[model samples]
Target: MRHYQPGSVVQMVRDAIVGRCRHIAPRTFLMVAAAVTGLVTGVTAYLLKKMIVFVSKSVIGIIHPDGFSLWFVLLALCGIILSAVFQRYVVRDYVEDGCSRIIMRDLRERKYYLKKRDMIAAFMASSITLGFGGSAGAEGPIAFTGGAIGSNLGRFAGARKSDVRLLIGIGAGAGIAGIFQAPLGGMLFTLEIMAMPMTTWAVMALALGCVTSAMTSASLAGFRIDFPVGSFSDFSLGLLPAVLLLGLFCGLYSVYYNTTGNIAAGLIARVRTWWGRAVVSGLMLGVCVSMVPMLYGEGYSAMGRLMSGDYGVLGVNSVFSDMATPPSLILLAGAVLVLKGIAKASATRGGGVGGDFAPTLFAGCVAGFFFAQVSDALFGVRLPPVEMAFVGMAGVMAGAVRAPLMAAFLVAEMSGTYRIFFPIIIVAAVSYATARIAERVIRNVKSCAERAR
Candidate 1:
């Protein structure tokens, strides 16, 4: 104290703060860290989204206004090449689908760590992929990035391995909540899909993270509902049977979707070179986009247009003189439903750094629209297609991810309505049941085939 210098005083104060932080209870420290992580994750999600939009407008909008042009192919090729270069040079041997893998690893090993370079590489790669019409979604990469941030932060704070895993979930949930502006959905997604134990502390941490992220995102991006369907106001008891049927169909479709994705991924995996895989996938995706322009990118804008009955905007030209014919519309919508699954699968398989969440939602929209049209045509059911589309979204998500509660709550939050909760629950339950049955059947078939061989 008698020989105190300015530098020594600053160092002493820093040491005192560090010492105080070290003495803080683990639970209190976790809670505080989680809040900060959520805020940071929300800001990251918002900025990434804005960047995608800006780049998309600048690259795709200026070059290819009609959604499907030769420019689309060229731009996609360039994006893929650039992503490969970045991954190779900046983040060596980065894992694909990093979020899902991280969650699985954390569950199995109860340890989590993600390098800062990997996080940056994922964010950059996904932005480039989506910006150039890669036919994928941003949710997966964002979630992974959030988890990386949380894991690194927790490690720096000297958290235990188990608590670090929980922190990863907290950050991931915050990312989802920020993107969708649905805090409950984000929390449930982490708890259900990630299979995190539902301890009170875990739930508290996830909830706090999701709420903070959602609030931050809302403040920055405004509180606009994700999917706005204003035409469907009321629910009808007569729709239960129809909703059940839709759920069953959605489950079957989900199985087909999963199968197609696996097949495509396997085929693409045979190509050893990243550049070759990127080029081939880019070319194939380009051809598909040229044929069905609506299949480009995340397909959210097209879904919104479909919900609002703006089919032309989606490049669906009417063939019949009477544009109101349900059959013609049904055929177009069905084609989209089928093609979209294939295109999205192909895109993901071909080195596109994106997630299946948005593509699944896109397929759900097509299925719901097709169901409404078919029911009106065949069963004389005048159910609103927009409402059916929303239900289909929940059903497909439940089946594909096997998380009915998460799907139901997510759709409800996205729609900003509790009016359709009953139908959402019914559809989600049935879809989940159907998907499980389908999985068992496929397993049995495969076992029988192997035995015969």
Candidate 2:
């Protein structure tokens, strides 16, 4: 047994190392793998966001410093056309519901693998879609990209099939964390929206990934929060009823937004060719932008202004330079709040590569501000619009996505304080409950109709 060559000891050590690695618990290995995934996903998300900003500023800004001009509209059309051509000729397939696709793949195949080419294609398409004023969000593409990265990494590391799904969740959460710089929000989104199993091990892994990713992005990006609404010292128990009413309103509006978006998507789906859909959607979007101008891009700039009490600043940097009276501003805001969802839905279904994530937030902002304006006009309530705007943001997100915890945490994190935590929670809970009830009612009605048929 003791007869060994000079290389025998080296080979024995190599075997021992391999054996040790094999002996590691699957959960332990998955946790470690998740950390690596989070790191990579965070870095990738950071770079992707910067790329979008650079493209939007350098390309779109140079061409149309005043937003939603004819030049901007033409460029948006061209970008959509180019994206359609790329999808047809090069990618050959476009991912519509990025998160849903990832979840479906794992459910059907028991394994997940994101092709390198698909990741690149999604990234490029999303960049072009948003950079050229497509009314969409970056969250969907970024989440998909993160899942792809995690899936591939897990496969490379010899993780089990089940473990790969968890890794995908971890990466997705990390992506959200990176984008919003909100670790808790990311974890909750993964748990609630992605329907990630809530085992202790899974939670730990997701938390680890989200924290790592958020920290990574924050460190690199200097920890900038998206919308920083100032302090809210006007806490009034008298406003509780109004807050509840606002929540109900937001829930109803969410239903309307979802219905409108579905209808728009169905209509757009009638187009057989990608370029045809692009042209139709592009023309529709151009018409919308030509009128509102603030409907351009993700509407974040408009949202920020609303939160900062800058009502007269609508289309400030855009082509519609005419400042409006307070009454007209209210009407314009109402129009934007009503039509923005349809526009966003059209963009997504009409061959534009973007996500519904940002649209929901935009709708929430509009709903909140609209509620404030109405309250001030009707009841002469001295309610703070900014505070209501923040609440509305949480309300719409919760109702639309059915993720109250995530929505609340996201709003809190974005606002850089938890002073309004109670209001945020109230709005989120009410909106979520209302949305669920409404969905149930719709389902019952549909079922009754089917039975009658």
Candidate 3:
């Protein structure tokens, strides 16, 4: 290895690259930069996912696979404590509420510099939380990490504000693409979820970034769709009524989801010390997880089990295992659905780190499954629980995150087909509308109560 003069060779190389960049069209340069960002974000997503999996497998290895073990609660509590300590001491930064932070910065159109630690802090914290069964998703943390990567890249290149903002969107979109391997879904996420205005060039850049990230992740991880609805003849005009009802149910469920999360966070925030918050959250989460083992982690495996018609897995390693009847299983699903939001809130607010995407999707699956079972048992109407589960995912996510297009496209891509696209679109629309109305009513009621006081 040869040593160069300080600020000599490095500065010369930087100047050379900057000079070359000046000759290129702005759009062309942006596209190139977006692709590079996508590549980097993809690798980061892959690494973060592997970290979670490694920790998750290790934790699961020690647990009794066939029966309930009290160790689940203890191990999960340890994870929350460890994550809180790491964030407070090692990271020494504010890394929570990553998606909200990004949106606020974008809405304000402020020139904020995301620190280098921001790129890795959420990634590490979320992995520890989820790996130890902290009942949350990875999507939000990865998006935050990706946005930081894009922001820092723009800062390094001295890009304009508009360009930096666009890059941030691209990175976030690519991050989702990398994690889910859904290019179209990723583009929709950036456009709808991020509330970014899209021009022809911007759309092109976002698409390129998302596609490249998806390709990279696929190449590295060997592409596989987690929940695949192989063949279903259950979607018809007769089922349309059920679909509509499910949509309404999901809408109301989304209201509960948002409300529960907010309430839990608010309650946890009252704790004066970080350890106190962790202990409080840990007790709540442990009780939920102990009673319903399916509530642990992102609950993807539980969702898959439901989709495949193995409802018994919902009660695995939990107190509900003995109640294996269909009606009882439906009730168990309902319990998991409600408890999931609380568990997710506990994980993130209790010094752990995670996202809402997984929890909402998990709840949607449960809601759909529960509705199908109850409808058949009560009214003697048979609806496909599997298809309903899939559509419910889109509906709940659309309402919870208020991104119908993103939710619809994400489900479509996840299933690798457009067979259920029409139902997904309808359900997502209904759910979003219902959620909006419910939120307004709740807001008015609170206002009235305050005025009376």
Total backbone collisions for each predicted model: 0, 1, 0
Q: Answer with 1 or 2, whichever has the higher TM-score.
A: 1
Highest-lDDT candidate: 3
lDDT of 1 by residue, 1-453 (tens): 345577687556655655676899877877887898899999988888888887788886577454335766677677666666667776774545445665567658755876767557668888888887877788888888888888877776667778788888898888888887889988987988787775787788788999999899878988777787774667788777899899998899888877877776677678899888777777766766666667778888888888887755445422222344566677667666666666665565556677767787888878888888888888787878888888888888888878889888888887788888888889889999999999999999999999999
Arranged by lDDT, best first: 3, 2, 1
In model 3, the clashing pairs are none
Residue 314 shift from truth in candidate 2, angstroms: 2.8
lDDT of 3 at 159: 72
Give the TM-score (vs. native) of candidate 2: 0.90
Stretches of model 1 off by over 4 angstroms after superposition: 1-18, 316-325
> Per-candidate TM vs. native?
0.91, 0.90, 0.95
416 Cα displacement, candidate 2 (Å) = 1.9
**What are the per-residue Cα lDDT tens digits for candidate 3 across 1-453?**
445587687666766677777788888889988998899998888888889999999988887456676777787798889888888999896565545455447547664567788888898899888999988888888888888888888767667778888888888888888887788978988887777887999999999999998889877887877676577664578778888888898999999998998898889899998899998887778778887889888887778888988878878887678788878988888888878878888888878888777788888888888888899889998888888888999999988989888888887887778887889999999999999999999999999999999
Could you give candidate 2's per-residue lDDT for residues 90-131 as a string of tens digits? 888676445445544664676577666655666777777777
Please give me the total number of clashing residue pairs in predicted model 3. Answer: 0
